[model samples]
Target: MAEKGMWPVYGHNTAVHLLQRTLPSPLADNSSQRGFGGPRHAYLFVGAQGIGKSTLAQVYAQALLCTEPSDRPCGVCRSCRLIRSGNHPDFRLVAPVNREGAVDRSAGLLRVEQAATIIRDSILSPLEGRYKIFLLQDMQQANESFANKLLKTLEEPPAHVILLLTATERTQLLPTIVSRCQVREMQPIAPTVIEQALGQHWQAEPKQAQLLARLAGGRLGWAVTQLHNAKFDAERQEQLETLWRLAAANRIQRLAFSEQTAAKGSQPQLFNMLEMWTTWWRDVLLAQANCIDACSNIDLREEITRQAAHLSQESVQKYIQTLKRIEGYLHHTTNTRMALDVLLLQLPQIV
Candidate 1:
């Protein structure tokens, strides 16, 4: 829990607004009553990564723990104070631990031990707050054993306990767990929404904000990351140029260009770059097929048009399918060099 005047920052204003709307009404609320309708337990928030699922969970938890009991958390209340200090006895956070016994900060997976610990703690009454709120971030990372272990408690959670699970991919979770919880799907923030947020928080110039928003693909976290990344602009330009040159060239030159691009970075980085290139190329192919309205890589529209003029629409479509296959294979095999080499060799044939 964060302290007074401190809440986890998020880029999605609509999500914050949604939580504000979902909080129990002023007339029905009691200081001890938490969650919707006096603490009915367990909620699942599902969405894409970096789309504010975890942030929303925290906001809801804060609302549950607020002692003052307004429409939302009164930041100055005793319960809110406790939560902000991370000293709220009723608020338990179950997340994966690392080798050093610290919470694994990266892709924190909830393990059996952590789930057990949460279950053990749930048996007891809250030390201060009205109800116990468990904020489980990244539920998709929880293994079957851990998820199953959670089932019994989740099925019949304590009257004073609430379980809030956040996941980027809900399909990765067991259907049993999904069925027991009130699920809310968090949508990706629109590019315009992201642009407005960036402008408000960062005072970014309109043109720069629009560009960042376009590159972000409706993910504010990614937009923020791009804002901080010194080389993002240059790298995007270079990648676009490389794709254009390869697509426009003769078969031999295209193959040679692919090999050169493939050999430029470390295996993982090279693979990632190729993945981006492939996505951009696919968008170009789509634009060529008169699907320009559906293309995501709109920033490269002009370049796509330039390349599409020289290539047959069918050839571009074939290349797009080949790139999809290459992406699929990259996930399974470790021989990236060989995989990429073969992909590069075949790409020229598509042209």
Candidate 2:
């Protein structure tokens, strides 16, 4: 399903073509950025989580460092292989790390220590490739204090250092940093495209591939990750059961459930719960509208139909808005307990 020469990136072809054009063209001799022809000092890959921003960034780095005579990043080359194995000498991946020191995307914000390392290394030359690439994932998690530390280097980075950053949105980053980079807003991959990739590229079974494509909701990376997560479907089912139980519970019971989940203090759990609840309500709305085929949670069409039968479309819409509001509000508040309480209080009584 991948185009010849664009092996790794299937969803982000425009960005891939743009990066390929910048590879080692005659115009690359100049150190300054030349529109799409020459590489810029910095690039910001913006998209939702589980999108292929990181993948596209790595592919771009491979092409920049690839030694192949033709089709740069001939993935067989030593540089490409090194990067694929996460052992490339000149390529550095910097992201928020948990207390354990391993990279963790949910670790909240990029730390001052990581910025310091990047600033110190910016002056150094490449160890192997012509360009030293630094991939800074989850820039949205970077606080302004830490982000400002790299402004100087980000503005006028060494000609040999190419900075690649990934974030869900540019608005979350400092305006000064945004101005210093070329922003690539990656688009969502179509379900059909993702399904084909699953069957042809990953050799996934046709039926499973079809189901995953619908569940992924246009996120190929999420679909691909689900392939290796043995407990994915089980976890989804658990959330559905919790949702169904809470839907029929009284106000006190609903509030108690929130307290228990919040007391467990797992951010990923809270995220999954909210996202699953929100999307399921959306499916219910679609089902009520007689658009079950267009629902993202089509695998649970029967459950969605049952929910639609019990709830009025108005109440479903209201709860959907409440979920979306809480989602945005949670980004700014640490008092998740209170937010969840408010959210549960607002939900229409299901039974």
Candidate with maximal TM-score = 2
Instruction: Tell me the lDDT of model 2 at 56.
Output: 88
Model 2: residues with Cα > 4 Å off, grouped in runs? 26-36, 69-72
Writing each residue's lDDT as its tens digit, candidate 1 over 226-318 gives: 677789778877866666566556657755665665566355456546757776767777777888755656666776676666677777777
| 1-351 per-residue lDDT for model 2 (tens digits) | 567767477777877877776766633553654444678889999998888999889988888888773445788899999998889988999888776667788846788888888988878888877788899999988877679897978877888888999999899999999999989999998989999988888889998788888777678898899887899889988988888888788989989988997788888778877887887888899999999998878678998998799989999999999898988888877888998998988876667
Name every residue pair that clashes in candidate 2: none
Name the candidate that leads on lDDT: 2
* lDDT, residue 112, model 1: 85
lDDT of each candidate versus the true structure: 0.70, 0.84
Residue 106's C-alpha lDDT in candidate 2? 80
